[model samples]
Target: MSALGTPRPSPLPAPPPGAPTVSAPEPQEPRSRKWIVWLVLILVGGLVVWQAAVKPRMEAQAERASAVSAIKAAKVFAGTLARTVRVSGPTSSQEYTSITAPIMRGPEAGRELTLLYLVDSGKIVKKGELIAQIDAKTLEDHIDDIGDDIERAEADVRKRRAEQAIETENLTQTIRVAQAELDKAILEEKASETRTVIDRELLKLAVEEAQARLNQTKADVAHKLQAHKSELRILEITKERHVRHRDRHKTDLVKFKMYSPMDGLAVVQMTWRGGEYGVIRQGDNVTPGMLFLKVVNPAKMQVEGQVNQSESSLFRIGQKARIRLDAFPELNLAGKVHSIGALAAGGWRQSYYIRNVPVRITFTEVHNKVIPDLSAAADVTITEEENVKQLALAAVRREEGKDVVYVRKGDQFERREVKLGLSNNTHAAVLSGLEVGEEVALEKPAIQMAALR
Candidate 1:
């Protein structure tokens, strides 16, 4: 106010001497409130980031994991695709002779015969060689008993004949004596003319009585002879029956020892016991008419096997096959289908309901190792296609009435329809709509995709 007659600016008040000077706090918001607001803003930003990026990423990761776990994939390949029917069975011979249990008779009839001895299987046997022996003790005993009975019956018949002869002789002598008496009586009656009337009458009565006695004696002798002949006939019949029975038992005893009729390898027959098949051995009882052994010509070998009904149609009379023996894996034999059964086997009452057709495969060349009853597997080539694109059957699926496969495209599968040519249990030949070297899903991919959705 003193410089040019104008008012001067106001100045701060002076502090007290030697005292600490303090300025009042400027007007401001609270620190705690500012911190709370900044914290709230950060939380909102984090929630927004999670909703925009992290949550979706985590969900996608879960879906990818599920897809990986659920789907299986295979690579398609180009190769020579051959549709083959595979079957397994025991090897046999085309011409074989079966040795069966002998026909039993007499006391041993209608009962199973015990196997007393059996030759080792796979032995080469000549004609008339013993292959098996059945228990003949019972039959022998029966034959002995029948022989005794026959002897006894024959003796009885002889004794009866002798008695008949003796009785006939005695009756003949009595009849001769009666005839002599009648002759004497007749003479007496003729001489009666020289006697008195009363004496003549008496002599006539005596002659008539003697004649009646002779006639009665003759009738008695004839009747006795006829009865003796009838008794002798019955005894002879009994002796004949005993002799026939003895002969029959002897015949059965001879049959107990089985001999091979031809030169071949002998194979034991399978006996059905306890609901399963087992090799016939000594001590195993066999019924009459049961097959006990088979003599097979090793020079002419064949395979007897069964094929499923599905593959039966592919087998023909001349279809070529390659056989592999399970016992001798190194031996590979060539063969052809010789025969196909007209009926299906193994139906109801079987452990499984699989129907099979009997097939006979004849070997083109015989080998010593390819013996009878060796287990073998045959691969019969039904059809062959060259340089064809094939995919596993598992990769092929049916969708909308069309064969479809899922082709892998950049970590994802794309559905494509395919035209199938030749197919088998394991693979299917693709004629169109699929390419070689492409990866295809072996299982359905739609399930995993649906789950992800």
Candidate 2:
């Protein structure tokens, strides 16, 4: 044992036997991890390729197949086909009375007529009911003045007649007195034989003088009588003129109170005032001959529409129509064309090149919701066919100067030519080359396939 506290290392024993010189086994080299990293990288690369390229391509192919199988198509059907022209305008009563401001006469003429009373708009009124009244105070005053003038004229006529009678009576007395004097003179002349020659000569001259005076007096009486007749005639003519004037004013007074000519709904008219168009109300000043209101019979209504000149030929009297009021969505009434204008007229607010023909449609059925001046649209049937083959317009395609449709045949669409008759916006009447229950592609099959791809 060593003196120090540390113990000595133990010595290895030598391999004594020569069976094998065993050396310490060499440390085997550690396997590399690079192959495992490469394998992980390879697997990651394959995953990226599948997500970015393979999956999207597979999805696209699936969608293309679905679109090719899902092409939209429709079948030709037998139905009632009608060609209609849409006309829109305002609805109005067929029977209506236009009420205008009364034209004043006499001194009130040319003056602005003020409305004193006005009925409420949209009021139901009976015939002969007062609808409006113009301010007649001025007119009434003028009439009174005319009446006074007429009275004065009549008085003057009577006074002139009395004066003429008195004058005639005095003239008659003068004529009688002159005749008596002439008689006295003649009697004196006859007594000449009882007197001397000088006395006889004086009596003869006195008789001649008296006779001349009587003739002159008679002439004066005739002239004065004629003059009196002329003066009386002038007075009578003046009085007649005043009476006629009064009568004219009386007629005008009656006009001031306006009445409904027929039982109807009273609708006030719009007038231009205060720089804008508005309804005429009480206290508004209306001019002579100006239309202020209307009395429209609601039971008898019509639509006044104007159609293009090109379409005028399609419209004729007695054509059936379906009317729709824009104000009331639920009301659909039947009507017919009542009249068509013989000559087309150009609208004042439209272009000069545009001409429209006036059309009137009378309602065959009355509805309580219908009212005058409401905006309405009508479908006038120009031609109609029942139980005819009709095809959807979307199914048609114009190709090579002809109309063609894609008729479905098994798994393919065959392009087929078709003859079209009456056509509207949505469908066309198939006159030939198409049968009922045949399916036609709404969209081009080739185009839809290409678009999906």
- Per-residue C-alpha lDDT of model 1 across residues 212-245, encoded as one tens digit per residue: 9989999988888888888988988898888888
TM-score of 2: 0.78
lDDT of 1: 0.85
In model 1, residue pairs whose N, Cα or C atoms come closer than 3 Å (at least 3 residues apart or on different chains), thus clashing, are none
Model 2: clashing residue pairs? none
lDDT of 2 by residue, 1-453 (tens): 433323555665788886677776543433454566678899999999999999999988777657756889999999999889988899999888999887766655787888999999999999889999988887778778878888898898899889989999999999899999999999998888999999998899989989999999999999999999899889888888878787888888899898888999999998888899888899999888999899998889999999999999999899999999988988889999999999999988989889999999989998877888899989999999998999999999999999999988865788899999988878899999999999999999999877866
Highest TM-score model number = 2
Badly placed stretches (over 4 Å) of model 1 are 1-80, 88-90, 108-114, 135-151, 194-208, 270-278, 283-288, 299-313, 325-331, 350-357, 369-376, 385-453
Clash totals for all models, in order?
0, 0
* TM-scores of all candidate predictions against the true structure: 0.63, 0.78
Q: CA lDDT, every prediction?
A: 0.85, 0.88
* Candidate 1: RMSD to truth: 13.2
Worst 10 residues of 1 by lDDT: 1-10
